[model samples]
Target: MRAGTLIATDSGNTLAAVRRCEGSLERMRGLLWRPALVPGQGLLIAPCNSVHTIGMRYAIDVVFLDRDGRVLKVCPALKPLRMAMARGARQVIELAAGEASRLGLLPKRVVRWQETLTA
Candidate 1:
């Protein structure tokens, strides 16, 4: 998975630092063994509309995005063993619990993914 960040183009503010989990294996392993995501950290699963937290160690905020990076839905503080989905969503971002709200990632807001510099 390649690391990146989600930024609001309108405000030029960062929403979160994320890793692109595009492959099936990568998406399947989503937050399974993680204790919790630190602030500003998240996972991006492309071509996804639904997600399950059956084996996640901690709750998370699920932000659904349309093909154009528009926020479609947000499932906040989704606890373990839960699932969330949004119609017409092309990607899902698994953020730390409350991270979406803290970053103002509300429905209709726009965000763009940018690959950050890596050493």
Candidate 2:
């Protein structure tokens, strides 16, 4: 996964270091066979409306975002084997449990992601 920062455009706050995971293979392999994300780490899956924790070992905070990057919904502390979905969502951000609460991610909050250059 390529790394990046999620920033709240309104408050200018850096939400976390969220890795970008695109393509079918990457999206399908999300959080599976992966270690638990640190407090300030997350995964951003684009063109995703729903997610499942079928093989995930740790809980996660799921944030659904619209095309314009406005938050549409949040499912916090989603445990393993659970599933989450949001209508009208164009992307989803999976964060460490409680990380969304820590960042105060709410509906309508505009969050922008900036990719970090990797050598």
Please give each candidate's TM-score.
0.94, 0.95
lDDT of candidate model 2 versus the reference? 0.93
Model 1 spans > 4 angstroms off: none
For model 1, residues 43-102, the per-residue Cα lDDT tens digits are: 999889999999777889999999999999999999999999999999999988999999
Query: Which one wins on TM-score?
Result: 2
Candidate 1 global CA lDDT score = 0.91
Looking at model 2, which ten-residue stretch has the lowest summed lDDT? 22-31
The lDDT values for all models are: 0.91, 0.93
Residue 23 displacement (Å), model 1: 1.4
After superposition on all CA atoms, what RMSD does each candidate show versus the true structure? 1.1, 1.1
TM-score of 2: 0.95
Model 1 CA lDDT for position 81: 94
Candidate 1, RMSD to the unseen true structure? 1.1
